[model samples]
Target: MTPFEWILAVCIAIMAATLLSGLVLVLRTSDVLARAVLADLIFYTMICIFLTWTLTNPTSIGYEVALLAAIAGGVLPTLSMARIISRGRR
Candidate 1:
C-alpha cells in the first residue's frame, strides 16, 4: 500500500478504537447530558470513518452522501442540545 493509504488505515484504526471507547462511556453514563455528549462523539467518529473511506475510493455519489451526513452530524447535535436545555428548564 502507498504511504497515504497506510496513513488513512492507521487513522481509521485509531478512530475505531475511540468509537468503541465512546460507546462504553455512553453506556456507563447515567446523566442525560453526558450521554448526549458521548453519543455526539460517536456520531462524529462514524463520519470520520466514512470520510476516510471515501478518500481512498473517490466517487461523486459517495462524496455527496458523506457531505450530507457530515452536515447532519453537525446539526443534530445542536438540536439535541436545544432539546436537552429546554427539558432541563422545566
Candidate 2:
C-alpha cells in the first residue's frame, strides 16, 4: 500500500474511535443538556468521517452531501434547543 492510503486509513481509524467514544458519552450521560451537546458532537464527527471518506474517494456528490448534512445538522438541533428553552419560560 502507498503512504497516502496508509494515512487515509489512519485518519479513518481515528474518526471511528472518536465516533465510538462520542456514542459512549451519549449513552452514559444522564443530563439532557449534556446529551444534546454530545449528540451535536456525534453529528459533527459523522460529518468529518463523511468528508474524510469523500476526500479519499474524490467524489463531488459525496462532498456536497456531506456539506449539506453538516450545515443542517448544526442548525436543526440548535433551533430545537432554542424552541424548548423558550417554551419553558411561557
Candidate 3:
C-alpha cells in the first residue's frame, strides 16, 4: 500500500476507536450535559469518518454531503445543547 493509504488507514482506525469510546461514554455517563457533548462529538466523528472514506473512494456527491453535514451538524447540535442546558428557556 502507498504511504498515503497507510496514513489514512491509521487515521480511520483512530477515529473508529474514538467513535466507540464516545458511545460508551454516552451510555455510561449520568450527566445530561456530558451526554449532549458526547453526542456532538460522535456526530463529528461520523462526519470525519465519511470525509476520510471519501479519500479512499472518491465520489461526485460525497463532498457536497460532507459540506451539508458540516453546516447542519454545527447549528442543530449547538441549539440542542443550549436548549438542554437552559431547560428550554430563552
Put down candidate 2 lDDT per residue, 1-90, tens digits, no spaces. Answer: 788878988998998898899899999989877777788888888887877777668885996787689679868988877766576564
Between candidates 1 and 3, the TM-score winner:
3
User: TM-score for model 3?
Assistant: 0.94
Better of 1 and 3 by lDDT: 3
Residue-pair clashes per prediction, in order, are: 0, 0, 0
Question: What are the per-residue Cα lDDT tens digits for candidate 1 across 1-90?
Answer: 999999999999999999999999988889998888888889889888888989888877887877788689878789878899688564
lDDT value, residue 2 of candidate 3: 89
For every model shown, what is its TM-score relative to the native structure? 0.87, 0.79, 0.94
Models sorted by TM-score, best on top: 3, 1, 2
Which is the winner by lDDT between candidate 2 and candidate 3?
3
Candidate 1, residue 64: Cα displacement in angstroms equals 1.4
Residues 8-51, candidate 3, lDDT per residue (tens digit)? 99999999999999999999999999999999999999999889
Q: Rate the local accuracy (lDDT) of all candidates.
A: 0.88, 0.81, 0.93
Q: In model 1, which regions exceed 4 Å deviation?
A: 88-90
| Number of the top TM-score candidate | 3
Best by lDDT: 3
